[model samples]
Target chain A: MMPEKVTIADVARRANVSRQTVSNVLNSPDLVREETRERVRQAVEELGYRVNQAARRMRTGRSRLLAVRIEQTQDGMNVFDRFLHGLTESAAKAGYRVILYSADDDRSEIATFDDLLGAYEPDAFVLTGTHYGDVRTSWLAERGLAFVTFGRPWGMPEGGDHPWVDVDGAAGTAAATRHLLDAGHRRIGFIGWPEGSGVGDDRRSGWVRALGEDAEDSEAGVLERRTDGSAAEGEAAARELIAAGATALVCVSDSVALGAMQAGPVPVIGFDDTPVAAAIGLTSLSQPLSEAAVRCVRVLTRLLEDDSPDKPDHVLLRPSLVIRRTA
Target chain B: MMPEKVTIADVARRANVSRQTVSNVLNSPDLVREETRERVRQAVEELGYRVNQAARRMRTGRSRLLAVRIEQTQDGMNVFDRFLHGLTESAAKAGYRVILYSADDDRSEIATFDDLLGAYEPDAFVLTGTHYGDVRTSWLAERGLAFVTFGRPWGMPEGGDHPWVDVDGAAGTAAATRHLLDAGHRRIGFIGWPEGSGVGDDRRSGWVRALGEDAEDSEAGVLERRTDGSAAEGEAAARELIAAGATALVCVSDSVALGAMQAGPVPVIGFDDTPVAAAIGLTSLSQPLSEAAVRCVRVLTRLLEDDSPDKPDHVLLRPSLVIRRTA
Candidate 1:
């Protein structure tokens, strides 16, 4: 059995204030005098009065909940879990809660958005697993909804208005390539996803960019073998690359690297630095998720507060190389 | 620019009904005549009049959201993700959304519960990673708040009313031990956590029970080695078990099993069938997380609807043995 709910009237009577003053204390405390606010706050505490959620929402349209989508890839990387760990921790510290929603397709996602907005009124949204022609961006942008994406908006060029935070995959592989070059390995091949995939392409670009003078050796037609980014494929591709005279490899993901290592271990680097990589001592690039998450919260808070910068800024976080025995 | 919100007045005009009739259509359509209800609903769709959330909530007192906490263990496992995937999918299908919250300690969890209840009023909660002396059970119970736990209520015995759903860890290990026995392995060792942990102890029990006729041959004092459940410790334990003349090993977790496999491939079985196990061809027990998640949703929904079983029934789901090369 629940105890009878203590009301604003009860708090008002305890504090010798009007019901309106109590309402103001709960809603916009700034509008209440400091002395009155203190009195009302104490009354609320002494009475254990819970602010009526429905009434509070009607008065101030803030839900203080941030919605994020859950996505899983076939190969099963734990990047989303790590990102969420950071996202939830950071969002909580900034005084917001996270809500998760899943929809099968773009149309369902929009429907879910409409349902949530109409019902819960989440303060903003965070989109994950972003890809080219992600309808969510255009839909949210059209509605002027506050949101941030984990992936770079591949459809848009640099400096567009919508906020996004993506790990620089190109920079990560470039660092790996440069490291191999410094170690005196001339021929470094990149094993990545097929062409036209945004993140995969970005990672491959980093490898080519790092080659500079050795660009001819790193061309896609010659050294690059793009599979669906699996461990088996990584191993097969590594064998082909080794036969083709590549001395070192920079695979797109840890699973691929695991496969490459199995084929032959000739100084291979992987991305994501998953547990398997660490267990096997594979050097890989690690996304600074916690730092990026903190920045995401800051940007989202700014957006929520309507204190965003003059121009919408998209943030790109750098991935650091975790050098292990393999690299 | 924001689109103009469709008003009840517009819906009322479109439906050619009084504003009160339109309000009745949204809040308590059963009170209105069927013909009038259909007219109002059609108007609502045509005019796109979103029912005022605050008014609807005040009438129904249901947020249609379920709360769950996120906890990470020393060894990273994606069980939570699988569980959440099942949960969100099930809940969404049942017309509910999930809210994720993080709290480091019990006190903070209760504080968060109070905050969420006061602010958003989630319909119910799903508690994960429950442990001994979990105050959350009693705290939520005292408030008469609806909830379900993923782990069995450790302190409680059979016939408790508080709803809980736990994976049958003992059954999983027992199955592993039986499989080893059937494969002509007489001496099987168990690697588990130190005694007194509810889950670890339960897993150990399964191995001993399966040893039935030869239980003395696989006593904890001899064949069983308890560690902190680390891969390195698992490797060390496997060595000790091997020296003790154990032909096969049953591990409490995939991390420990991975280590055992590294020590020597003596046909090992692991639990949780994590990605590592699959990649390395280590046969492991896979928890039926999706099934558990569906049951959890069904139970929580029943609790929310006040249609729970006569006595709070704690459900235990079985884990399936995923056979691979290692076993």
Candidate 2:
């Protein structure tokens, strides 16, 4: 956070020493008398010295910068754009500036983290795109760096010791499934990305759970199809599912849902509720992205401030479905 | 930019003075002789000095931060998202961290600029969304602030004495209109936003230019419709144009073009080549945002470095047309 600057005179007055002693204690701690140096350090702490006050140079590092990676934009996706706007708004409210860095993968992200630490010494990092066994979290934890993620640690229960925020994909898909089931569609087909990724698996489970005991999950599995996340793939898969007697569909993303809707309009629902979904009137689920971004910043601010006992370690928010003509 | 750390010993050697002298000159310049102080200041200048250096305490304000406002995301628009990603990428490559700030209007933007200057002392500002008689540019200029804009200052040719990089909306719309004219559509209609904004007016001019003298300007003027930028508005306008004997349509934005395409399929061409356009096979124009962002950062970086007489003060880039089934 942008902690206010504590002037040399303020620190000197607090320590009952001259301004020169405070300057000496900062630029050259060795020149000050032993007792005076200790008194000056305490005064600096009590005064809330921030900004590049690491002029306790090489000690008490604070730069009021919050670092996060800006991923390259993907076709048919604007989720990151919404999240960044909310994040920058939230971070600014807390008096912290967010600095962006780029990386192609986890390895490079860690390397970039190392570079940022040496150059800007950002106060903390806000990580996104969390997955199982993500090394970025462990790397920061091992270094004892103050950081928080915008995604839950996939393999761990509630991000273990670190803090995180996640939008519940299962909750979204389950809602979509129930919506179709209530409309008298017994055989609701689920179209999603190939399994293995945490998000893919999480969304697939929702459809299965919503189908309940009457709908058989083991009957040839013809109502389920896992494919790449593209409109073409979605259209192909939907055609096959329709041939298999499916009367409704739940898609993992708007892109897929767009294609699925074109494959004969069988009450298709999508996730992420992108602009395309709104423009075309596709029923879809939307993540509470603004809320998630605010929570991510607030939680990290508390961690950096060492405000204990009250802050929760993790937050899991539900996704809401926006109904339109397609459903 | 990120200038490297220069230790006291390095400054001492450069000034041919003892390390203690350099320390005294930095922490308490009053204790050092007048000539020695000048010599130290010269040494500080002759070599690269990073931010948070001793010169900072001497009021030579340098924080190596580049401030830019991040606007809230708008429905059916991803143009800013592409531009920001490019700007941050280019800025980081030039060794500057971009800090985000927000304001609802010009007055608040100026106020935010004042607040940022006091807190972070950002090295410079990069402005966007420039419009007719935009007061922000003059405000920054009056203070002798180092800044650049991503939009040309409307009402001023080539942004006058200031530096700017703008996408040529006229060039883009002209290309779109020519594409339709080449297809033998003599009665081509144009749908755009209500006039006043430089971008809207510029785009409208292109369609007029492409029609040439053969298209009567004094007729009913039924070949053109200016409406709000939305798909529904576009469709309504397209319907009117079609009923008035228009054979094809050119839209100012993809959102409007999408609606026009639905108003009875007359080979629609839209601007911004958005994901929705690609998904539905709508022909459109797309700005070279990455190139524009790079030029903006490069020009600003040169300005910060005081490398004048070489860097161009203005850059205007052309948009490319992407053909699909619609055209």
lDDT of 2 by residue, A37-111 (tens): 999999988776533423432455566678989878778465877888889888889878788887889999998
Please list the residue runs of candidate 2 whose C-alpha ends up more than 4 Å from where it truly belongs after superposition. Answer: A1-60, A156-160, A213-220, A309-312, B1-60, B157-160, B213-221, B310-312
Model 1's A-chain: what TM-score?
0.90
- For each candidate, the DockQ is 0.55, 0.24
Give one digit per residue, the lDDT tens place, for model 1 in B53-155.
Answer: 6656776777888998876534554478778878988998887888888888988999989877876688898998777778888888888888999888875
Give the Å shift of residue A86 in candidate 2. Answer: 0.6
Query: Per-residue CA lDDT of candidate 2, range B166-267, in tens?
Result: 988888888888887778878889999987888888888888777764454334256899988988999999999999989999899999998998899689
lDDT of each: 0.84, 0.82
Tens digits of per-residue lDDT for model 1 on A30-89?
999999999999999988888776776676777788998877545555577777878888
Report, in order, each candidate's fnat.
Answer: 0.54, 0.32
